[model samples]
Target: MENFTPSISVSSQVTHSLLARLLALAYVDQEVDLREVELIYGIALERGVSKETLESIMLRPHSVSTILPSTPHERVSHLYDLARLILADGIIKEEERAMLRRSVLLYEFTEENADGIVDFLLEQAQAGVAPAQVIQVVQESI
Candidate 1:
């Protein structure tokens, strides 16, 4: 085992971690739409996650090994992506809010900041703010 190198790369794992977490959020409402699936796949490809890895993770997101980014900024980016997912169906489900709230702590945000940002993001989404713009505001505001 001294020279063993896993076939999956570190970047792939990181993308998988992000994808898996987002997949979990996607499922909390017990419905997955084509648009949401397409967006997740597109984002995963952009992040260097192999199609095979993404497919496997989608098959069993809860079992995925999560390796969340270390920096607060990176973690916050993941939160933004998740918040964008909430807007995928054009209607934010209550289950999505609950999952996002749970994720705030999972990503290590302080309760106060997490609560504030999630609320702000939802309002932004409702107000038709683009995800990128919301991300910018969140990154700056938090």
Candidate 2:
């Protein structure tokens, strides 16, 4: 079975749950795979979000959170953190790379800003930053 550990930090926030599910789906079948279905179960349990609630969100064709950013800065921040994760392992697969590129474009991050965030994540990962630190960065950045 896949390691579908729902991040313990994400609590009953619908938006957070939705994003976690979407990311988990994106990670499906990758070299570093995530179990999309199991992740759904895990997040619902961790966050106390009902399974039905997550099921509804999962039915959407596109991720709803993409357009729900409250501000441009907020969107950019999410993009930065996502890009950081996508590139953290140093060898971004083609699919992951394309996703990051499009996300940066959609979030309107400048080339310089994107590069800076990517480099920062690479450095941090190389230095063996803890998962808690990485999660903190994502929460703060967004």
Candidate 3:
């Protein structure tokens, strides 16, 4: 892991994370589109998440391994951003919910704290909160 060097950009990492969450949400209700795959791949390339990693994330139908926290604010903000994007279509897909649950695991959040995170995400998703506001909330909480 120490030797692993991602070739993708910082912006792309953020983008890829959001895209992954969205795809997972889309997957909940139905099959994913080719365009979605292409979009994810493109973002993955830019974000440095290998094609294999992207595939694993896309293929994950349920919870994934614990996410070693990089930064509390970043992890929470990503979750918020994803939740917002998932609800942007005005319906919460099962795939998205599953992905969010899996994401919580991947983000390595504490079991007790995960519920709060989920609550915050659901609230933001339902309320149509702005991404900026979501970030602000995550930042303040962190």
Candidate 4:
């Protein structure tokens, strides 16, 4: 094992973590739609995550830790992505909403503000507001 080293990079790890959570959110409704899978795969690919790594995480999401980005902007951008994924299939189940609440907490938002944040993000996502624009709005408000 002297020469052995972990192949996954820090960036890849973050990608894995994010994809895992997205996958979990997609599965919350007991049905993983093709749209959801496509969205997740698209994100993984954009982040330069290998197909093998993506598949591994997809097969075992629980193995990956829930590690959000360090910066507040990155975290909120991720939250927006999660909200976007929740609306991908054109239906938002109560289960999805609950999962998003838990995700908001994981993203380091206060419990008191989780609902409002989630609602706002969901509304923005539904309105087709771009992620960058949302990030700008959030950062300005802070």
Best by TM-score: 4
What is the Cα-based lDDT of residue 29 in candidate 4? 88
* Candidate 1: residue 129 Cα off by (Å): 5.1
Q: For model 1, what is the error of residue 70's alpha carbon versus the real structure, in angstroms, after optimal superposition? A: 1.0
Better of 3 and 4 by lDDT: 4
Relative to the true structure, candidate 3 has a C-alpha RMSD (angstroms) of 6.2
lDDT of 4 by residue, 1-142 (tens): 4897867677667777888888889889889899998988877776677788889988888799977788888889888889989989987789999989988998899999999999999999899898889999999999
Model 4 earns a TM-score of: 0.91
List candidate 4 stretches off by more than 4 Å.
none
The residue-by-residue lDDT of candidate 1 on 13-102, one tens digit each, is 777888988887777788888778887887787677768878888788777787878776677767777877888788888889888888
| Ten-residue region with minimum lDDT total, candidate 3 | 61-70
In candidate 4, position 1 carries an lDDT of 40
What ranking of all candidate models by lDDT puts the best one first? 4, 1, 3, 2
Clashes of 4: 0
Q: lDDT tens digits, residues 1-142, model 3?
A: 4787767555555555555565665566676556545645654665466787677666763434333336676676667755755565566666677677777877788877776777779788689676567878777766
RMSD after CA superposition, every candidate = 2.6, 9.4, 6.2, 1.6
Question: For candidate 3, what is the lDDT?
Answer: 0.64
**Candidate 2 segments whose C-alpha is farther than 4 A from its true place:** 1-32, 36-50, 63-65, 71-77, 80-91, 122-142
User: Residue 20 in candidate 2 has what lDDT?
Assistant: 57
Instruction: Report the CA-based lDDT of candidate 2 relative to the real structure.
Output: 0.53
Which pairs of residues have clashing backbones in candidate 3? 25-96, 28-95, 67-106
Candidate 4 lDDT trough over 10 residues, lowest sum: 6-15
